[model samples]
Target: MRLHEHQAKKVFKDFGISTPEGKVVNDPDDAEKIAEEINSPVVVKAQIQVGSRGKAGGIKFAEDPKDARKKAKEILGKKISGIKVKKVLVEEALNIEKEYYVGFTLDRGSGKPVAIISSRGGVDIEEVAEKTPESIAKEELDPIWPLHDFKARKLAFKGNIRKEAIQEVSRIAQTLYKIFTDKDATLAEINPLVLTEQNQLLAADAVLNIDNNALFKQPELAELREETEEDPLIRKAHEYGFDYVRLDGNVGVVGNGAGLVMTTLDLIDYFGGKPANFLDVGGGAGSATVENALDLVFQDPNVDVVLFNIFGGITKCDEVARGINEAIEGRELPVPLLVRLAGTNYKEGLKVLNDEKLRVVSDLEDAVKEVVKLAGE
Candidate 1:
C-alpha cells in the first residue's frame, strides 16, 4: 500500500511538521476558489502517485487566481507518467533558500529502520549515493528504542545542519520516526525539505509506501492506493484473492510458498528463460484460488508456459493438484503447464496431474529445461 502526497502531508501536518498549506481540487473553479482563500502566489500541482511531476509538466506556478485557473485547466485530465491528473493540490508557493532530504526506511542488512539525511536533495537518492556517497548521512536505530535525541543530534551534525536548525531537524526526525512506526510504513520520505526565505523549515514534497501486511490497521492509509498505475494482472490477482507480481519473462509460476515461488523463478532463468510473473496462491489454496491464478497467468500474452511447484507441508499437495485439475477443466488454458509436486501426498498429487494430461516432472532442473525448450518453440 502507498499513500498519495496529499494523504502523507495530512499525516505530516498532524505530527507538527510544517508543510505548504494546500487543498485538493477536482476542477479549475475549485482551484480558483482555493487560490482566493490562500490569497498568495499558489502552485498548482497534479496529485498522482508517480514521481517527476515537474519533469512531466504536471506542476505549474501561478502568481494570481487567473493564472491558477489557467494552470488547473491545463493540468486537470492530462496524463502524467500514464496516470490521469484527476486532482490538483493548490498550495501557497514559498521561496526556498535550501533543500534537504529526510527519509526513514528499513535497512535490510541491519534488520532495523535507518534514518537518512542529505544536504543534496531534490534528485534521485540512488544517483546521489552512486555519484557523491559522502553527502548522505545514515543512522541505524534499534527497533525497540527507535530514534533517540542523541542519535538525532548526531545525524544533524553529520549532515552539516546549521547550529540553529539542529534542534528543529532533530525534532522533525523524531516526529518522522513516529509517523513511520505508528503507520506501519515501509518508506516515509520528504524530498527537498526546504528552508524558506523567512528561515522556516517545511516539507515541499512527500512520498510514503506502507507495508501491505499492515493495511488492516491503517484503513485510512489504504484508501490512498492508486490502482490506475498498477499492473493490470497484479490488480486482478489481488481482486481474485491471490498474490501476483508481473515480471518480464515467458514462464508463469504458481506456488504455495514464497521460497518455492522464488526457486521456480530462478530455475526458469537458469534454463535461459525469464519468468513472466510470480504468483503465490499461498497456503490452503482451494479450487477457486487456483482457478483464478490460472486465469491471470493465461491473460498474460507474454506467458508461453506455466510452472506449478508445490511443496505441501501445512498446505496439502493433493489439494493443490485438485485445484490445478479444476482450473484446467474450467477454462481454456492458452499455455502448457509443467508441474512438480513434492512433500505430503506427493504421489497422489502426481497421479491427479498425470490424469489431466499435464506434463509432470520430479526434478526441478529437468522441469526447467523442458519448460524453457517448450517456450522457445
Candidate 2:
C-alpha cells in the first residue's frame, strides 16, 4: 500500500527524521490557515499517491497565506496522474543547497534489502540510473543485521555526498532502514533530502509503501490504507476480495492462480495486445467470484476486451463457465470476452459454454489471438 506524502512524512518525523512543518488541508481556506500558522513562504503540494506531482502542476509555491489559498484552489479537485487531489500539504518552502536520495527496497535477485544512496536527487532515480549509473550507490544489506553507521557512511561517500553532509546522510539512511524494517515496508524513500540554508538536513519528500502481504502483521500501518490508497481500481479490487493490479492496457485478464494469470498476461502481450489488469480468482473460486471478476474487469474504461483463462484444479471448470455466462446474460457487454478453460471438469465446462453460445477457445494461444484481434490492439 502506497502512503501519501503527508502520511509518510508523519512516519518519518515520528522516527526523529527532520521534516518541514506541514499540515494537510482539503479546503482552500484551511490551506490559507496552515500558511498563516506557519507564517512563511510555503509550498502547496497535492496529496496524491503517484510521483512526479511537480510535473503535473500539482506542486506550487505560495508567497503568503492568500497565495497558498490560490494555489490550493488551483490544485484541489484537479486530477494528477489520474488521482483526484482531495487534500494538499501546506509545507514551509526550503532553500535547498543540495539534494540527496535515500531509499531502501528489496533486491529480489539477491533476496536481500538494498539501500540506494545518491547525491543526485529530486528527479527520477531511474533516469539517474540509466544515464549516470556511476552516481547511484547501492548496498545490499543482510536482513539479519542492522545497517551500521560506518557502512552507511561509506555508501554516502561512494555516492559522492560531500564530506560536510556525509554524517547526516548516513544517519538518515540508518534511520530510514529502521523505518523500513519496523513498518514491514517494501519501499522507504526520501528524495531531495535537502541541506537548507541553515545547514540542516531535512527530508523534503517522503515515500513509504508497505507490503500488501505484510499488512496483516502491521495493524497501524494497515489502517492507513483507507486514507492513503487512492487508486479506485485497486480499492475496488480489494472490496471484491481479489488480488489485482491495474495496468495500462485494453485486455483485462482473470485467471485461477498467480502463475496462470501471469502466463495469460504474457500470452496477451505476445500477441501484441495490452493486458489491462492482473486479477487472480485464486483456487476454488465459485460462480459468484468469477462473475464478480468479470464485472470488475468490465468496469475499466480502458478495457477493450477481457480474457478469462482458467486452469482449474480444485476449482470446478463448469462453475467457472456458469459464472461467465451469468455475467454476460442481461447486460450488453462494453467489451468482448474470451474464455479458455482446461483441467478438472473440462468437458462439462465446454458443454456449459457451448450451451450459452459463448465464444470459447480450447487453446490458450488461440484465445489470446482472438482477443487481441477483437480488441484491435
TM-score of each: 0.67, 0.79
lDDT (Cα, tens digit) per residue for candidate 1, span 43-64: 9998877667888899999999
**Backbone N/Cα/C clashes per model:** 0, 0
What is each predicted model's overall lDDT from 0 to 1?
A: 0.84, 0.90
Candidate 2 lDDT, 1-377, residue by residue in tens: 99989999999999999999899999999999999999999999998886678988999999999999999999999986457889899999999899999999998768899999999999989889989888899989999999999999999999989999999899999999999999999899999899998999999999999988899998888877764447777777888899998877788899999889988898888889988889998999999999899888888887988888999799999999888888888888787777889999988998887444357889999999999898884
Q: In angstroms, give how far residue 212 of model 1 lies from its true place.
A: 2.8
Alpha carbon lDDT at 127, candidate 2: 83
Model 2 misplacement above 4 A: 36-41, 50-57, 79-84, 96-99, 107-112, 118-120, 123-139, 157-164, 195-200, 211-230, 248-250, 262-275, 342-351, 354-377
Q: How far is candidate 2 from the true structure (C-alpha RMSD, Å)?
A: 3.9
In candidate 1, position 14 carries an lDDT of 91
Quote the lDDT for 126 in model 2. Answer: 84
How many steric overlaps does candidate 1 have? 0
